[model samples]
Target: MANYLLKRGNLWWVQRKFPVDVKDQLGTFFRKSLSTEDADAARLAVPQRMREFDALIGQVRMARDEGDLFANADEQPALDQMLVRYQGQVLSGLSNAAQRRHLRVLEAFGAFVGLNLTAQQLASRAKPVVEQWLLPSFGHTDAGRRALNVLIAFYDWVVECGYAQPPNAFSGYRIRPIKSVVVSRKAWTDNECELVLTSLLAEAERPANVLARDNAWRLAWVVLLGLSSGDTLHFVCEAQRQTHFKALSADWHKTRACWPEIDPYWVPGLSPGGPDGRRSWQLQKALGRRLTSLPGSLTYTGLRHAAANQVRPDFDAWLARLQAIDLSPAQA
Candidate 1:
């Protein structure tokens, strides 16, 4: 039915000329055989062929819009030489870490453009290529802004050193700020808590790696301390023996909040002071990584909230009852 459909002897075919704008990239005409002499069958296939033609045109147009439809040939030594000069001139005094960070961004751009362009050619393509790169690569996050900032600085140096002309391509481009989402720290449900604990205990028994086994065993005890006595990961990590109370205790370093006394649960091959005297936050990260493989979104901090939710209306009575329970190291 479409004008693009035609008959070549016995076999039917579809053909259409590409739009003038995209003709160079996509060629003059798109032609394909329908592989059928039956007119009714060809008619039914026409719609699908037309859809394919539309899709090809759409892709070429999008690439053109992004200024990447044409492939540019490699220009020798210009971009690399300029980057070398930039390091010596602008980045000389910066720390090694800062220098590496800036250079990494420039190298990424070089890689994106196939390492094939003069400074002038790169500058000309910078605007569209950067806009395309930023949206899909980093979106509106701070990392995107940081990368843009790095490029803007690089281009400013390029212009200043006469590698490219005035009007910096990367200058004045700002990714829209990301909208802040307030995450609610809701407590895990009873069944969810039970599931996570069961999974962690099971992992502790037969983890494929030593690190996984150690983290799983420690996390099981950590979750139990939080669920039983509202003990935070930090408190549990830094807990010390209290001779008078005949149990372990720790004070919250930030708020100076005292934790309810509870007996220590030790796992084999792990110290309460952490591996090689690692800090509480370090241990929390190790344990958190282990939790990620389990079902549901569970957090170390959320366990404290779960404990608060469970022991409502009578805190002292709940603590007393929890302390009365005979918890052995093997139970963990």
Candidate 2:
């Protein structure tokens, strides 16, 4: 037969001749190791191997004739099943973190549409999901960009496996910067840091409720810690005593990879989903009010850049100078 099993040393391999029209593109014969040494195993593997080879042949032929947009006439599987197969077969050997992220992207896609939907159905609905869900939700972040790339790659794999049609619905998506003015993560200048700290300290010292006082204090440290420790506003909001900080002077690099600590001060009234919904939002609101007096649009991210700039050969010495500044009354 044209497609048959062959013995290669100790393993069984599948060998098949390419159609004449696609021989130049796909080679004369497709040869793949079946990873089995037993003849019985090779014989059992025939039907599935034949199906895979035939699907590949159909994809090449369709790509040539219909330009990658046509699906094979064969019955297609459910979207969920296809995703699982794609992850297991196509991305089997990829890094676990990458694989997990890809699956998460796929899951997000499925949530937007329906996992039970077929490839053809998914292709039809992809544009709206791309514009509405993907762009609005993730258009600004690096993870979003990576997810778009992964989605495109997954579709390409689906087309190649004869699981879906082509011209890939997600192929046109691109990752662009969210802001027109692309500023690098610049740390706060010495003058800017002094201005920010002095302003926040004044706010913290004002008579206020525990919630208001704690929010003001933490928000201030968020700026100082962001600039000095390179921690994000989000990280500052979610910091915990047991996880993020154990003592005043702690080494974040020594902690687990998932939990990164930055600030030395322990926040008293910080809780998950305070009256403002997310604790991060509370910090954001407090910081936003204080930053209103400053020139230019200085985001917390900018503070992180400022702190990064402060990192020099004498980082400890510079940190000591920052630590020596009196914020004890506010901290108390």
Candidate 3:
């Protein structure tokens, strides 16, 4: 009973008439035999057959539009040939890793625009396609910016080499800016610092592996050092030797000045390189995890702020008082 359903002899068929504009590319009438005598079966077959007809029509329209856009498409250099020439000329100086990264961005672009287009056709259509299709596909992220940058670079090369016209498609295209949220790093209060140090000291006393106990002790020192001196974890982890109160101290690596003497604190029998020869970063990460397991949300970096908070009106006095504070388990 559908409008497109027809009967020719004993067999049912589905047919549609193409629009006047596309009739030349497609035919005047689209027809496919349903090969069913039953009216109910023919109706079911008509919908699927109509979908196929519509798909074919869409393909014809796309082909017609492409043909119109590039009349002498066959005369232009193919995309693959252009890429090979561009690689040899422009990307030859880059390292293999850098070249591969560029290729990945190019490959994603090629997959979207397709390889059938000539370098000239692509260059002509690049701006609209990149702004509308390519950028939106990658979204507004670091990856999207990288992709945009690579494409712009590629087109610049294309124009310089005389393969394409001037005014790169992606040259001025700007991806939407990423909005960032500001997270406040709050300074730990006196009671909070005491609680964290007490927990770490308690952890150090428990029976555990040498590495675990060493890390707990090191974290306690890191916290104490940060609180007293307002120095970073990196400075503490990288310290080669302990400076006692009476010793003439060498210049601190970060500040290039002699650091004020603090009470010597060292993990018993643990090397400066850390237990089991672990790197500074590895030790820092382990200490960070141990710190995270404690009750408060304040990180190791927050202790520096706590030091400044305690300094208030007098820095030297506060540092002298904090330096003599004992970190022994009973005193913690």
Candidate 4:
């Protein structure tokens, strides 16, 4: 057997063999606890540890054969090559925007440790590169955690591709939670929603700049939709125009105000500019000013949550009717 799996106390111990030639430089066998007592759990964990051990053995064998593994490989591979392959094959399922974000994470890591460096060069010094450069660059935030996650995937891919070895240096790292940045989300109150609607409705009626009217009209729609439907801001903004939940064709392009026949008022893509595209920030600021009780950073998401709460009385009434129906049948 290349490695041994033994149970010591309640934990499963994975003992990997060290190369006899480099036994003095390394050791006889490297042992680590798999930290599980269950045999099935230990069996599931063995493949990963085995892959890691096999990679370590390859490194030792390579070093013994050629002075260094890096020296033995053909023209040093570019980091971008692996990234391209990874994106095309592994990340093909992701949306364009999601794929771009993952690429940015990879790019950030590349920047952390010069883009020109190969996977082998990176894997060799993973610990220092992560601790000194990667972690520090990201700080202790959600973005940092995302960066680490991407790096772990990248390293794992490299290992699978035979460009790097096992025991992926960046694997098993957890992001340290930073409590200061956490914010508790709260829904908007009825009074607050009313204030927003009143302010925007007045602005929509304003006979001044056509642009201002357009902006107000868009915000009013968003606010009303969010307050009633509980749709997400992204959905509120990007969802195609629909008449009674049925999608509108591209040829049906006309502002909801102009297309009363199409019944576009209740649809998402209502505005001539198409759902407050460029002016969304301005609209957000305007709504923020009206609802002074909430932070200016508040968006339609909070508004929608509050709007959902507005339906509670209706929901309760419906529930009561359902119970009444059951009781009537029983009483008769």
Best candidate according to TM-score: 1
Which segments of candidate 4 are over 4 A away from where they belong?
Answer: 1-76, 181-332
User: Which lDDT tens digits does candidate 1 get at residues 223-332?
Assistant: 66567667766655555433121343432121111122233322223343545563465667776776676666667666677778883223243334333333333332
Candidate 4 lDDT (Cα, whole model)? Answer: 0.60
- Per-residue CA lDDT of model 4 for 25-118, tens digit only, reads 5677878788998888887888888788767766755555453323534545678656655654566456545677887887777776776778
N/CA/C clash count, model 4: 0
Return the lDDT, model 4, position 64. 50
Residue pair clashes in candidate 4: none
Model 2: lDDT to the true structure: 0.65
Candidates by TM-score, descending order: 1, 3, 2, 4
Better of 1 and 4 by lDDT: 1
Query: How far off is residue 59 in model 3, in Å?
Result: 43
Q: Candidate 2: which pairs clash?
A: 186-305, 186-306, 187-305, 187-306, 188-306, 227-307
lDDT per residue for candidate 3 within 205-230, as digits (tens), equals 56255455545655665566567567
- Find the 10 residues in a row with the least total lDDT in model 2: 252-261
lDDT of each: 0.64, 0.65, 0.63, 0.60
Provide the global lDDT of candidate 1 against the true structure: 0.64
